[model samples]
Target: MSVSDHAMPIGFLTCPGTHPGSPVRRDDAYEHDLQVDALRPALAALGHELVEIDWRSPVEAFADMPLVLVGTPWDYQDAERAFLDQLDTLEAAGHIVCNSSAVVRWNASKTYLRDLERRGVATIPTDWAQAPDISDILFAMEKFGNDTVVAKRQVGAGAEGQSIHHRAKLDPLWCMEQPAMLQPFLPQIQSDGEYSFLFVEAEFSHALRKRAAPGDYRVQSIYGGMEEPFEPSSADRAAAQAVIDAVPFDAPLYARIDMVRGSDGGLLVMEAELIEPFLYPTQGPRLGVMLATAIDRRLCQ
Candidate 1:
């Protein structure tokens, strides 16, 4: 209840220079770096210390801190096995990860899509294939029977491995060794755009409308896209909740739900970002305070 009672310093782990030679690439944009700078002062105002650490650091470095929040570690997600192994080791040794390793493992993969699908949540139909052949693509094309399709790497952000293709240009081997997820491209993304809703500790915070610039579906700033504030309708809020509830949240943290309405005009999950998502704090100025308070409350328990 008091500031002194909840003053354990919070450290944010991110990938600093994770990719040395490719600084200009989408993964190395320093979005997490900027968030650390923005949230620190706000957390400090609540008598909490905010620390930023490179994700590559050994587990012992974070053992002293009760909460080690993951910022952006794009590379970590790409090779999730190693990253998760490290977190598992830390947890085994009594270190704490905000949101916990359990949540991280579940939310890290797009495979969670199946879990949601089983729960009766309508999602873009996904097929996980590794180095699939032309026949594989053709089969998916027939199954979907949709005019357009999107092929994306199983693990990525900011649309790093997304490709839009018609039946004539279907290339299943495009993914190489990495597993890929295929989905019918929703035309609404080009017309109405995608909706990104931010949630801090299971509570709806705010939403943003991300429109691809011209002919892009990535909708990230790096791709020359734009974002505007949006207040989600109740249906949108319910959709966000449904996705969040599907994930087991053992620890307190913020989440971002990137979604688009399907052909039936029902919302479907694009991705559930728990690790590190651009909070757009500038759009929701009160977000930092809200996040700090949520951390304070959770830690005090």
Candidate 2:
């Protein structure tokens, strides 16, 4: 197909269709599909087709599409080997995959925290151990010397596998047997809130400041957090840019940098979501348009 024709047929790979946070089997995902339906027309208006595919589809089917945007491959993280093998096969067969598979693999594990730490990005003090030992937990408690800390699965998403516990309340036996991350809970997560920087291609698309409504620490909207449009300050913009530039893999078609303030009032990295992050289109009016344009460019390439 010609470049123009190719631009008209961009494929949007999302999860099997359904409502987000609904009770559904992981193997038969539908929530992501439902979201893509809403996002489809926005991309379609820009002159591109949005093709939805299930994880069960053969990778070869997408080889001819100009771009395969990974909209909501939530299941891909858990089954990395299968997911990555498909991506590899597709790329080798000359297909373009947005939010590059390499980046997906790296970010899926959440262990990327260590990689970023090595790069000098300020992050919460963290320790990870598999099936943690009670003694190890005790040691970590003493090591960090924080009264309260967060215990969560290594690959947790959307507050899944997350729990807050005081040192006295924690069970050392539970720590010894689960793959988890232990880190001091930031009181600032309740104070100043978190900043999520959204980017489309290399441009700073928009940003939002998220804060839990009251008596909560999770800033996810699903957890009743409130998000307000934020105009990143010059310093904030620079900080966001630094992170974008630091991405070791290809620039993702989309990314959201989640950061928070520390006790000392300095910014600390919370999470770098290159996968399917909730882009608040209502808050950031022009972002959808900007993102559509970028997708068009990728499709035509």
Candidate 3:
């Protein structure tokens, strides 16, 4: 397919809090700029224009866009239902929502891991609970036979509302305020770090390893975590691909498969970030070109 002669505009959806000019913008909002810088020129090279728009903007504002990429709406977790509704509305109006609303919904909750596990994708052992209390945590610890456990909200991002508790330090009053997933804490996180495999249109793009700060276990940049380009062994790459294949849906426009090495020396799916995952353009320099090419192909189709 040939590139269009005219520069068609593509929508890159962000939230008000992540917009550059927002008074309440997040400190990590610079990630939005980095991604834009990476993709804007590449899209322009393909005779396409990238428009940064707040996702909460009126529906009419997106009428002219042929495709909308679910970009950095980091605040979407706070209003997940509304976010999903907006995507459904845009898709219904004939704008191609990359990853699509269905994909977003399937991925909105961490429980999707269960689906993948059912499809034979290896995942960390997790106990799902509704607003787990101290008793539940203890049950998870006993079930996994591990003294340390990590508890995270079923619907959250960037390590928000996450906690780590050791058997010795267990707080009797501690309890999750929302539906949560409890898993034994793998000490490998501090040693080997977590690996991220990026895919565009289900094709591999690049890989990176994210390590937490000295005293933190969260690998998100907001927690002072750092990442570097990584060359994955073919076996490890295949492990990540298995996750994509198990997605139970058509290929999304982009995906970030985050994994960690399990005790048995195999990678376990940590999270399959299909919605608004930071692509780590710095680690994957060709990300823009690959994504632009894929988007152009989709547009041509």
Better of 2 and 3 by lDDT: 3
Query: Which prediction has more favorable TM-score, 1 or 2?
Result: 1
lDDT of each: 0.75, 0.73, 0.92
Q: Model 2, residue 274: what's the lDDT?
A: 85
Strongest candidate by TM-score: 3
Q: Model 1: runs farther than 4 Å from truth?
A: 18-30, 168-175, 249-252
Worst 10 residues of 2 by lDDT: 1-10
Cα shift from native, residue 202, model 1 (Å) = 0.8
Candidate 2: tens digits of C-alpha lDDT, residues 12-48: 6554333345456353344454446545666777757
What's model 2's overall lDDT? 0.73
Instruction: Give per-residue CA lDDT, model 1, range 1-301, as digits (tens).
Output: 2465557678676664432334544553556545766688777877888876667778778766777777666678556788888778767876567667887887777887888778767688877888655565666778898767687877667687677778766665654457788888888988988888888878877888999899777788889888987888898889978887776554348888889989888899988887767787777777887788887776777
Q: State each candidate's clash count.
A: 0, 10, 0
Higher-scoring candidate on lDDT, 1 or 2: 1
lDDT of 1 at 129: 86
